[model samples]
Target: MTGGATVTGEGRTREPRDAVRARLVDVAVHLLRDRGPDAVTTRAVAAAAGVQAPTIYRLFGDKDGLLDAVAERAADDFVAAKAQAARAEAHRGADPVKDLRAAFWAQVEFGVANPEVFRLLGDPARVLRSGAAQAGRAVLQARVHRVALTGRLRVPEGRCVDMVQSAGTGVVQTLLATPVPDRDPHLVGAMWDALVAAVLVDGAGSADGSGAAEPTASATFVAFRALAPQLPGLTGAERALLVDWLARAETAAVQD
Candidate 1:
């Protein structure tokens, strides 16, 4: 008797209202992906979903509301994928750098491939307020945290996180902005190579003819900050103070 309800054999069973919303979202996602954001009109989505046009407004307020749903769904899928990849890497005891690289590649690919979704989630105000954006950051932080635990992180965790995130966003935006004919096939790998060289301590962490240096006071400070909460023999207040001091030092070092 309404939009999204299925006709059963003499039963007239109705699908749940949430199912109709999900169906509308799925249709809108396809429209956005296949035909760009302009294609995701209220009429287009409703007609495509086999629902009445008024149902769109009834279910999602307006066109903006529908777009928000699409963005939310896309973010959930993207974050879930990164989370799963991080989990699999952790479970396998794999090199975090390997996982990090993989995750970075996936992120770049996702951003470029899903320009509509990326644009929806790329707003600064939205990122600051969005729970999905925070979850994505948490996933990236976990990856960076694992790398820091390997004693190879060249910078403090917070700095490393900001650098990687900024670089990843830059790479995606740059690649997406470039013309297809002029896009470099090696740009992604080159970026990864440059980023890893900067963030990670490669070769022997020594001075015996190796380019890398021994872990310094700064390095120790970074390591301590990374593991500050778990160190034993310190009172809770002491640990908090140490963490605070280390954070200040990390910021000062960056500034210097």
Candidate 2:
């Protein structure tokens, strides 16, 4: 009624307002997935959805608003998937170590499976400035906190959630940043294994010969876990800097 042109669907000439909004979003998502975010525009979305441009604005407020909606949808879907995976792990009566590992892999798998959505949620330049991003981060942080409080992990109470959240974020960031051919699954798997191992095993002695002694991949994760508790007081940019340094150190060590 507001944005989309009326079309005959089963002999009906009237279009529901909700249907128009849904169509616009669906088209916008397809455009984003097929051709990056830059290609998604109000005009293009309207054209694709057979809706008027003003309708998109009315429904979404603005381009950024639409992007925010898209991101929220994607984030909600990902959170649900992670929760489901965790539940399945619980249902199977998984070992704590194995359950953690499975959860880490589930995050990575989702990122790889939905690269566009992953990028939308992860790009700092795009996300940090947005209210939607902050809201999404809060939701995720709460979920991480809930898991840590359950005491299934052998990590410090202060650092456990941060360690898991950062590791998962890093995995997605690495995958998105690297070239396709160079996106080695083995390397990703090793990084994940090292992070999980650090959480499950305490002290330097337990991690000896665990294949994470090398500073780049394994040691870096351990260091981050050790340092996570100090992060809450940091600014977003500061947190990014710390994580970047850790990643660089890990990369160098792994290459060595």
TM-score winner among the candidates? 1
Query: For candidate 2, what is the total of clashing residue pairs?
Result: 1
Give one clash count per candidate, in the order shown. 0, 1
For candidate 2, write residues 77-117 as lDDT tens digits. 66666566656765675443445555667777878777887
Model 1 ranges with Cα > 4 A deviation: 1-12, 202-214
lDDT of 1 at 224: 71
Instruction: Enumerate residue pairs that collide in model 1.
Output: none
lDDT (10s digit) by residue, model 1, range 1-256: 5575777888878787899999999999999999999999999999999989999999999998898888888998999988998898999998777778778888889999998889888878667767888999999999888877766677888777887787778888998899989888888888877886677666422223244435645555666788988899999999999999988886665455
lDDT to native, each model: 0.82, 0.64
CA-only RMSD, every prediction: 4.3, 10.4
